[model samples]
Target: MIRAYRNHPYHGRSPLPQTVVAGWLGITQAQLSRVENGPPLVHLDRLTHWATLLKIPESQLWFSLPSRTPTNRTQQIAVDLLAGAPQGIGLSGGSPTTLKATAHEGGGTTDRRQFTALAALAGFGGNSLFDALMLADRKAEVVGMEHVRLASSLVERFRQADAALGADELCDVAMGVHTRLSTWAARSQYSPGLGEALQSALADLANQVAWLAIDGERRQQARPYLNDAITRARIADDPREEVRALACLSLLVREDHPSESLHCAEAALRASRGWATARLRTLLRLRTAHAYAQLNDVGGFDREMTKARHEFDHGPHEDDLPFLQFVTAQELTGIQGLSYLALGRPARAAESFRAISSGPRAGHRRNQVYYTVRLAEAEYRCGDIHSAAQTGLRALPEVRAISSGRTMRHFAQVKSRLDRERSASAREFVDAHGRAFQR
Candidate 1:
């Protein structure tokens, strides 16, 4: 239980202290500490209040308990409700039983009460979804979404949170929602709003997928999803959405059509201006700089890269977007490093890449692979074949796990370059993992 409490780390980072938390619950700090250190003996009411105030999910809090013991009938009912439908069910499934129990307890089984219970379940589901995503355990993520759908009201809340949290944050909630809704939509024969919602979710998923693809050097497969994301964004009737799609597309296509990439990215920036949040605008500009580098427009790349760095440095806290709250400053620095590499500035690229390479491993695995690949390429360009080979070797495991053609292509490109030098280790790594490069 102490391990669980300490592992979250978010609690320590929260502005509230143990005393504040205890005071809020009308308990002494020592009691709270004991609760934190020992088995979860805190009342469900107290736990729920603590979770809400701490911005942690109650499900996670419950799950963190040393033993899966339920304190009361209500807690047991909640556990059954959570376990019976690992994926959520409609108001009918076990909801009435729970509601009746609540009413009997003098809690008045109103629709509002039911809705609140559902929301809490969904919030728990969201936390589970986030955990699965962080681990890159796609199978677990899929299961988590089933629960998210039970808390259907969260979908709208996620959407509303998007504006405040930015695209990255939106992508977090959107991922599980997208997967769930897509399955639901297919099963329900494409219901109204479902298609639009799925499209919105897919657009976000595609961006992450595309990022993964690019990281794994599977550019070809990445392109289709990027294009699909754009189409979905257009259908969703949000210019800001379209801008994000186009910006990502620009990154995938930049090498093929640098001028067109720049044009598209510029257009996205223009469209997003004054319409999207500052983070969105900054992301668009970063995409433009990448395109500029591909076009060998050094001046343009430098200016835009500088702008991206400045904006990123002055950016809002990650907590502003609950979904993307995990994204750190180092990730943005990696982007700038890639921009430098694209502009043919090997030294500057190396500096940026080193920063990313040395940073903590907390973000997405795909992101780690992406920056590491860029660093390897930069090392190769700077005539450090040994470093490049080493980096390539390190990145191979992550690359193999990804299912993107673009990422494979990037790997192939790097491998091909290194293969010419007959580096035995590099060749061995390639021979072992080359199967993943296939389209």
Candidate 2:
């Protein structure tokens, strides 16, 4: 660990003596010697104090500790966490040399102890770090848009940890930071990279919050965030991100505002042409189909679905962005199925749904719930009352857990259709799940 510290650029240029550091920290020379040479417990306060005096971020101090050998269990755990970080969450593990350089660039004195702690926790497979960062960000002392942005990104990583994980707090923190950053960015002079960073952060936060609101049965609440995301994406001048935001808005508007949904989706496709990767193009196409189906445009939906299918059939390479890489054929099939159902093509919808439901990729519970519900709706439309009821039953737990208003609206639509036929099972399912829509 000592060698690692020495090699760090922050430490390499004009290394501070132990005695000098100890004096600055107001600690005795002998005590500083113990801290440097033995199994000494570095108090958090003292660590932060020394970091300030050394003009290095506290994160650098923690990450650059001489005792952080690969053999050290804690340090090894930290390294492992950095190794497997998800995309959009920022850098995880890199070469030690690279980390040292980055720390130097970010101004060694910024105290990101909480980020280090959260990263370490994520590496160790603990979710509590997610909560910790959210809590810390709420405190008054934790200002600085960059720090808040980092915390928000960490929360998003935690959300993507698993489908079942609740990201309410994460979303809330992200929204708060997004609001604050937008205000600051509006007033600040133009900085080369600053505007882009602020725009990206705001867009990401809006997306996260919109997702959470959608999950929590708050479609009305979700709409503004989705719109805000679109604004930020446009400011960033990244058509792919802009289209992604529009896609989200399309989903929100599909039921009641089909024409608007179609407009957003088509605009997304047009804006994203050539600028986006294949995966993004696939998503845009899928969304366009959904919008067309909502407008009862079967021909348009079919054309878009065909294009989307072709794109998904060609799997993304490993080098693709991690976020986009997860958009698989199975997922595309599910979306295609929903589009068919919306277009009143029960047979085609069932075929698409069956293809997805029969796959081994059903491990994704969130997708399973979404697809199952769509299948149930399609079965009802096809007059397969028994199958529809059974599928709805299987999807009930997920629906209740997720409690999305849009999902409940879909459920209600299916239930109303089934009710006309006096299907007892459908009635029961509605009785149990319909209350979510009231909120």
Candidate 3:
């Protein structure tokens, strides 16, 4: 057991690098390696910190207890609950290390499965990336008015991809478009309309890149791109892009800075009040609802969600921004369900999840896994342990295929709940899923 921790496969998948994890543990990386590599003389306090950082189960850790514990397990529950686990940001993992357009030949290509996944994602993404890359390689004469159409199409495609794929699969491709747009803007001397159009394209792509960063679970790292998006949005004076940038900032800060989240949501609403299209307004209301949920303001959450649903159902989306078209009544339902989770209304949350999908679409694999695990959480919260575990177990195969910090967090949360459960079936379910996640 002591030897197992040295080369634990768990650290390989962790978004936090060893240096960052060691910092959180208040030790040097070399010290951490030494402590983790050698005998089981690491202190109880350090073990507690590791459990909290990695979200390990107390029961599982105690089964191979180190000999260094002083006495009784008085601190056992403290280690188990970890009610206030530190929310350290993960370094962006699985993304291209830089914004450079990666060459497909030589050693740049990833695994076959990753290529397949990227292909599937790009299919739903309308091959805009492929088209953009092709145009990017040609002279400026080859990039005419159609580049604008392709840029707009890219936004819509990414909106679909956002709902379907996990963020890791989305990040690098988004950055590629972002870089292309930047290069064109810097070198080409276009007319006023063309330049504004180019800036709009750049802003939207930057927003997508930043939003994907948030979705990929690297919110802190998203700040630079997000700021660039906001600035370009103001330059282009595009309300839709501004709304997205605001909502993303709101989403990013809702956990750590709820007040700021509310402010950002309000800023989104204010920016879009008269100039924005109806679908854009609905998106803003949803952002506001999300912030309200984070603050536990039930009335505010319900009100904004109701408005979001009503506006989405009745409003004309024909004139909406292409990317804004993704905000459907069905997607809003999922947001409402998530708000219920924040409000501690598991029954309502489960009901909402049930409405999002009666059946899964073939290409929307990641969405299926995410919603299934969410439903499992609601079931567990309502004390239906058997159904909860069974439902979650069904998604393990899909979950294994993708990597998302948000998805991993949900798994960790469910694991914590199952660990505290007294039911033998629940424990068994935890064990099965536990090994699956370790892979």
Candidate 4:
């Protein structure tokens, strides 16, 4: 793949505009062009932004390093990080397994030409995605399993707190705990078996922290931790955890990069095909269905929802990963409703939301606010201006209780929609409730 990129560097540029790319890479247009043309040599300062802009798997995949071929370990790490979804993602390599490269008029320009490859890439995979990372013959530390179990307990508590409290200062606290646990996992003296287990736990913890950052809209802060989680989960040979991390990333990017998001969600499903418990399958398929809805692929969305419903009905399997306890019927219902909402079927969307009979529990406060606000939006879209305004006001208390920026945004959207109507209820709701949140 590197050889192909070196010969025809046109495909290396991202789909974003060149001006955006130049500014993001902190370079002049000419410099950005040179970097793209790639005899693959780049200065130290430029490489970080370059690799980042390209969305390469690891920060150290500085592909443009002069004439030096990377060490075996470095190359393997790069491969390991990307192997989870090699074919689907449109990074520099395109498809590692069966990449086909054709030289265009030249190698320097961004060409849309196709490349054909001999084989599609596949690396080490299965339940433990990173089973190969541990050193053989190492001895376990006396306190390893005990430490891992304690960390798992703390992670479970952190998740519960996130659901109830929202992503407030609690997110920072989770980040701190994750950092300390990750360092502890890296310290020497554990046996290979113990190290493997510790890595899985640490990855799971880091994923929880990353998810908080994502939900809080601190996206740039969330990405590296996600990368770390993916790497560790793969090395730990825990494909279930790897799938979980990938699904989070998929959800994060669905709005901004819907196609890439679809690929990522599908990749998560592919990674888990043989090993994921039914609940895990349900989670990934739900995410996939959401991506399809965003892309307006009605067929794809319906297909995934059907699969999700089947998985949910047959789930709560013994093989389910304990960390993913949040996978519940309510969450599934909300996602299905959301997909309908995205498709512009307001009546259908409202009907889906009507399935929930009562206010959400403390842990589902965010959902309570989110779905309620969504129901109001759907009602407004369906021409029930008075009902929409009244519904919006009813959800205000839950919105304020959760401290979720997302729910607050929903309130604003409902107000904006209702402000279009001239009804007394709409005008009153907008003046009293909507105005309070808009400012």
Superposing all C-alpha atoms, what RMSD in Å does each candidate have to the true structure?
16.7, 16.8, 26.4, 21.7
Candidate 1 regions with alpha-carbon error over 4 angstroms: 1-236, 317-328, 396-407, 422-439
Query: What lDDT does candidate 1 reach at residue 24?
Result: 70
Model 1, residue 302: distance off in Å is 1.4
Residue pairs of candidate 3 with colliding backbone atoms = none
**In candidate 4, which residue ranges exceed 4 Å CA deviation?**
1-143, 187-189, 357-363, 419-422, 431-439
Candidate 3, superposed: residue stretches over 4 Å from native: 1-107, 111-117, 124-150, 357-365, 420-422
- Clashing residue pairs in candidate 2 are 1-66, 2-66, 56-108, 56-109, 57-108, 57-109, 81-123, 82-93, 217-405
CA displacement after TM-score superposition, residue 110 of candidate 3 (Å): 2.1
In the range 1-439, model 3's lDDT, one tens digit per residue, is 4335434687564445557657876667765564554333222233444665555666765423333331222122112111111212223444322333444343424433353466565583243233222222334533333444445545556666666767766665555556655665667666664555556666777788787777777666676567777777777766566678888888778888888988998998887675566787888899899889989999999899888877877777334555565576656777888888888999999888877656445344555667777988998998899878777777667677776667767877887888888787788778888788675
Q: How close is every model to the real structure, measured as TM-score?
A: 0.52, 0.61, 0.67, 0.63
Tens-place lDDT digits, model 4, residues 335-363: 88888888888888887766652535524
Q: Sorted on TM-score, highest at the top, how do the candidates line up?
A: 3, 4, 2, 1
Highest lDDT scorer: 3
TM-score of 1: 0.52
lDDT of each: 0.53, 0.57, 0.64, 0.63
Best by TM-score: 3
**lDDT head-to-head 1 vs 2, winner:** 2
